[model samples]
Target chain A: MDGDHACCEGALAAGCRFVAGYPITPSTAVVERFARRIPRVGGVFIQMEDELASSIAIQGAVWAGKKAMTVTSGPGYSLMMEHIGLAVMTECPCVFVNVQRGGPSTGLPTLPGQADMMQARWGSHGDYEIIALCPDSPQECFDFMIDAFNLSEQYRVPVMFMMDECIGHMIEKVTIPEADKIDVTPRNYTKLPPDQYLPFKPAENMVPEMVKAGDGYRIHVTGLTHDYRGYPVMSADCQEELVHRLVNKINRNEEKIRHIIATDIEDADVVVIAYGITARVAVDAIALARKQGVKVGLLRLVVVWPFPEAVIRDLANKGKALVMAEMNYGQIYYEVERCAQGKVPVLLAGHGGGDVHKTEAIAEKIVEANKCLS
Target chain B: MSRTEIKIGGFGGQGVILTGFIIGKAASIFDMKNATMTQAFGPEARGSACSSQVIVSEDKIRYPYVKRPNVMVMMSQEAFNKFSPQIDPHGIMLIEEELVDPAGLPDTVTVYSIPATRIAEELGKKIVLNMVMTGFFTAVSRIISREAARKAVADSVPPGSENLNLNAFEKGYEWGLKQLEG
Candidate 1:
């Protein structure tokens, strides 16, 4: 299957019962498959008029006690940013699948890009946190789609399934295990009677148990800075408590949420940090660099947002030169540089992302970084 | 044992992407090897140029795109003209003789030509030309076994056209064997 189809199948496997989307390039296949397959899976597939309607429609489905998701590409993703902030404020447990294409606005609909890395982190106005997973292959698309939903439900946050067009359109074999082996986080419902349920009250992990609208819980969900009762409370105190819980929930649990696939980084002279399509190309470059006897390794990001600062800092502390390779020129390089903190040299091997980074170019960077050491 | 990169290019309606898909599926699913297929096409569905890159290897395929393509299959003159020059000198070329002329290509690259469209026409369907070429590719390249390619062909096409596609495949395979011998 293609990566988009694999993602759809993954959502189906994750018990996603509602999908609201507007058709967009690279990501159209995800919702198109959902429209075709959701009927058999006993779900609602809505085709909204635009990205705004589609983005909020999934939030409504989530409040109605359904595992919901929306899919879009670059332009559509830009349109949905406001709702992304809304999802964060409402503590909506939903998934946003962004099969990113080259874009400031509809730049390359059918091509690949990783330009939205920062936008996924801080696209919407205000300070908040999000969970974004980047899948490198069709198989990872399938595997990580389930993880995206599970993380969303566990954190009561809108999870971002960050995919590029290369991974979205690339075709490869994906093995889906049996139902029992797949782990799904069930909806955290308030077991307390509807009259006593405080909708915004945080549990031990700072994620409150949820209740459906028809289930008779008095829910006052809003985008405004609300208190634990889910009501609009305009005060510095209320804002501090609400914003801290929303941001701190993921930040405090970094070890649980941060997933980086690092191979041989601990004992390397130069480490290549990459994710999505760039990671695959960097792997090829790393192989060639290794053949030439360079002490090179790779740090492939499974989770891009809540960037893996500690892991990167540790690598930099070892005095290993780090080269960050992404499709977008310099979006992620600064992040790595900040983590490096002048401890070691940090370089960026990237472009604006119409096409993938060439293998030899990345290999050349690795060799040069290693050459500077010796 | 090492990686073999194959590039298939033609006009959009020629099943160029599906040709790469079947080859990748055969290698990865049926043959238990690792393969990845990435494709690109223009907005126009039929006339515009389209291409697919399939990488097959005994080990995992880390890089997705084709670098120095070990083999290239061109089903149109435009595809042949566009991609043939980029192929490595030691690579192999497969062309649809009815549509593409393999002139002005690198001298060292071994070139094979077949009238896959004419053969598919003889079998009463012009659409299965890719299947004939895929079969010929299976025979000539031996990247995946003929059985593996046959299974993939049976699995990929529409239900009613499986028999016809398989027949077209067999014709091409037989022709490929004859070419290898003659």
Candidate 2:
């Protein structure tokens, strides 16, 4: 399987009964595959008129108590941001697979890019938290889709599986473990009587138990500020509380989120930070650098959102020089600098979109950083 | 930590993608180091100018892509023309003799010409040329074990074609061992 197709397979394996998406380069095959496979598995697959409709339709499926997902690439991802914010505000548990392509507006429709790291983090309006996973391989694409769906359900938020064109079209052999061998997580549904249920009432953990529509509960969902009763409210306090609660559901649990994959930080002089398709390039560079007698390590951000600042800060305090490499100019690099707090020097290897970072270039940077340290 | 960057290029139906995965899996699963693989191309149903890469190292792999390949396998004339100029001076280049024109190769790099398609045809499996190239690569580079290559082949071949592929692979394995000895 390839990354995009694996995403569909993984979503299905994670109990996604509905998928709605537009046909876009690098991500169209996912929808095409789902069109054939979803109905075979007794699931619903819809080809929406555009990216916005596709996104909203998936959220609607989630609202009706079905696990749902949508897949798109660069241009489609741009069109879907408004509804992405809606999903965030409504606390809808859904999965989004954005198989990234080179872009600032179709820069390279068929090529890979990590340019959307910042977009995935802050494309939508308002100050809300999000969870996004970057998969570098087809198998990771398969496994992370399951994780993405699980995270979305557990936190009652949409999760983005941030893939790139490189991984999306790349094929590989993936072992689909026996269905009974894997552990699956589903959303926490409201158990209260229909009359007493408050859609916005959350537990101590800040995540509310979701109640689906048509379940005899008068569930009202919208992009506007809503009260606990799910009615639109214009009061400043109501707006503030609604946004804060929505953000806190993810923010408050930053320490508890198991989305980071950090390797060999202890006793290391340099920490190379990267994510998505570019992270794979960075990984190779670090290994090559170490061979040249530099004690370097890697900090791979599987979850690119919420930025994983705590880990970055800890590594900075440990005196590890950080190098930020991505297919974009400097999106995640800025976030790393903010988290580094001047504790360590931060370097960058930027490739706007046309070219990916070469391991040799990364290795050269590591050597330069090591020379400065020595 | 040792990092070696490899690029494998061929037509879409040549299993170029699987060979890349086998190399990466060898580095990650068998050798027990971090490995990252990336490929260029779409339209999975057909083979075009497909390319795949693998980065292998002792420590965790930081970056997954190769800027210029230290080793490259080109199974078609167009692929060879597209990638051969980028091979490092001391790098190794493997070409499919039936497709590549040796006259166009760089003087600094060592080129190994293999009759991969011919070998596969002789073994009654012409489509297994990619596997033959992969087996030859493992023998020459010793980057990954032949056993690992076999397992990768077994794991990746689609249903109902496994037996024929296994037979094809055994013939390729013997050819690879001979290349190493030579």
* TM-score of every prediction relative to native: 0.97, 0.82
After superposing candidate 1, which stretches have Cα over 4 Å from the reference?
B44-48
Against the native complex, each candidate's DockQ, computed on alpha carbons, is: 0.77, 0.31
**Candidate 2 residue B38 C-alpha distance from true site, Å:** 4.3
What is the docking quality class of candidate 1?
Answer: medium
Clashes in predicted model 1: 0
Best by DockQ: 1
- Per-residue lDDT tens digits for candidate 2, residues A1-374, read 66778888888889999999889987888999999999998999999999999999998888888999998988899999998898898888998888888888977877788888777878998988898889887788888889898888889888888998888876555668888876679779888998898888877788888877777888777788888888899999998888888887788777766476677767689888888767777777887998988888888888887678888888888888888888887898888999989878888888777556777988887788777666
What shift in Å separates residue B47 of candidate 2 from its native position after superposition? 10
- For residues B1-182, write the lDDT of model 1, one tens digit per residue: 49999999998778898889999999999999999998773373346567889999998888888878999999999888887887989999988998998999778998888999999999999999999999889888889899999999999999998999999999888878887787
Question: Which consecutive 10 residues in model 1 chain B have the weakest lDDT in total?
Answer: B40-49
Which candidate comes out best when scored by TM-score? 1
